[model samples]
Target: MGTLEGRLKGKVALITGAARGQGAAAARRFAAEGAKVMIADVNDAEGKALAGELGDPAAYAHLDVAEEDDWAQAVDRTVAEFGTLNVLVNNAGVLHFSPLGQTTLADYERVIRINQVGAFLGMRSVVEPMSTAGGGSIVNVSSVEGLAGMPFLVAYTASKFAIRGMTKVAALELGERGIRVNSLHPGMIDTQMVSDAAGGAEVDFSRVARRLALQRVGRPEEIADVALFLASDESSYCTGGEFVADGGATATHALKL
Candidate 1:
């Protein structure tokens, strides 16, 4: 649907959390690259709307990434609707900010359920179909927090770190099957999740950006571009790698010179 030439021609991609944010951005980019995309999310209204906007090459499938049955059904629906599963973008996640002591066990588990377990299920659910389709790519959206630690985001950091580890393990195991698994680490992206983590307060992004090499907050579309490369043959030799889209936030430590 875009003016750009096809980079993902004839491929079928399933993107979780595709109702909005980075997930939606990836869906649009993938479709533009000539890939049939399944927008899977619990937000039925937005998901359906996006699918409609993408027209014939896109469809919506209701999915709760935390639910195994939901993941199973979503994958089945994707393969049925698109005829094969070639790419997966596990972009659904929740952010919770709380100090280690203040973070409840329930809160930690909830974050893990969606961010960590959700990706595990997604990768597991698609292996057979993707293998059958002659191998595919799986991009797990982790965070800059995954590579390092940050105060007050105890649970979120843990889940993201888990995703990073899982991606490497999956890549090692699925490499021979032609499945490439990679983790994406983003920093200070302007999204609803960041807003929610700030308790709906206006974020002074400029202040956060000043500390990074790029000196700006990242856009969802920027991350989507990286996802596009991972999903396409452009990254054919890449697997079990960490793609950091942060504004160089992780390049330095606390002792700011």
Candidate 2:
């Protein structure tokens, strides 16, 4: 059980793509802060393992974010287990790299379905439950690409930008219901997402590090910290905003070498 003193004590959260990486990080942090978490993912083994590791108040739900039925089931299970839904983290995403000319419709739609449509479904699914709970927070994990363009990542860029746009729209529409929606734009972080897009080729972060104002790749834990603030009461006044943790990637213009 989450202690009474924890920031998220009594709150329940559903985190997508939580079997590993950033989703896993947020799950741990939220649990430590006293929130009950539903670790939703397609990877059953890892998701089950994580739920076991988190113990009481943390459970795993198999969710295919692209499927609307999966969304309904996950939300129902969350409410059934924890009693109410208060926080949602739409963190499941895939990265694909190809020139716009080389990108196939299938490839582009795949990214949009997971990153964009999934988020839309999540927001819609939670509205009624969140209203019942008096209010809630939604964190949509976008990328720096959402802020500006990047080469060979048209599909991913489009999905993230759509997430950014949808966040604001949800915020405006859901405010009366006491639900807040916000987007998180992260810079080059040390995560497996990019390498997976590169067919498992290891990324050399040194070159990218030199261009960042922080001179280092961001960590999953760091982004989790920002997410923590958004999930808790700390960001109550914030809604429909772009909360960026991109290591100053957007500070420089395209003209910069």
Candidate 3:
């Protein structure tokens, strides 16, 4: 295949949870598309290493998504390093699996803080800067659970649903300022987050894939591609939309014979 043209040229982006997994994939894609990227995460070593790999156009910022101050610093650093912030990908999140009754308040709050509150802070922090830059895109990485409830994922589902709702609200409020906000819902992605949720064991997605329309699990790169489209001007007409990259998992209503 021929090399793809730069779709994000002249853009500056900050992506949370970019040390690894889907966030890292999106960071790489953005850089490849000619965007100056800030790989923000708490994982310093990996984030810095990825920045080095991506060379001059990318840098790493230490960001603990749950902390408001960290969000401020990350956004400031991105603008300081790259001139302005044109894209913000709220991709940092946490997952906890347990029966609703068994889930502790502490665990539930932790998930909410990172997955929901974190995105909120990110959006708020970027608004002014993005508006000054003449508008930008904010991609909130939600999940399939955001659209529907799943067993043993109460906290995660709640947080994702919050992100989905927040995305719409931000889009509506920010549209006048030329900023676009959208949510991405990915399902059964092969990432470390899923492995950790599965108790550090490999996630056997074979059975789950059988129920989906595509009959396969998704890759982090696939979701990254969708994010790329949303971040680039190609999706200028899209805002407050739920862009699902789930292998068609949400296309059916669970009906058994």
lDDT of 3 by residue, 149-248 (tens): 8899999999999999999999999999999999999998999998888789978899989988899999999989999999999999999999998888
Score candidate 2 by lDDT: 0.93
lDDT of 1 by residue, 1-257 (tens): 34458999999999999999999999999998999999999999999999999999999999999999999999999998989999999999999988888889999999999999999999999999999999999999999999999999898899999999999999999999999999999999999878878899987898888899998999999999999999999899999999999989998999976
lDDT of 3 at 150: 88
lDDT of each: 0.94, 0.93, 0.93
Backbone clash total, candidate 2: 0
Better of 1 and 2 by lDDT: 1
Candidate 3 TM-score versus the reference: 0.98
lDDT of 3 at 48: 98
Model 1, residue 13: C-alpha shift (Å):
0.6
Clashes of each: 0, 0, 0
The TM-score obtained by model 2 is 0.97
> How far in Å is the alpha carbon of 89 misplaced in model 1?
0.4
lDDT of 2 at 16: 98
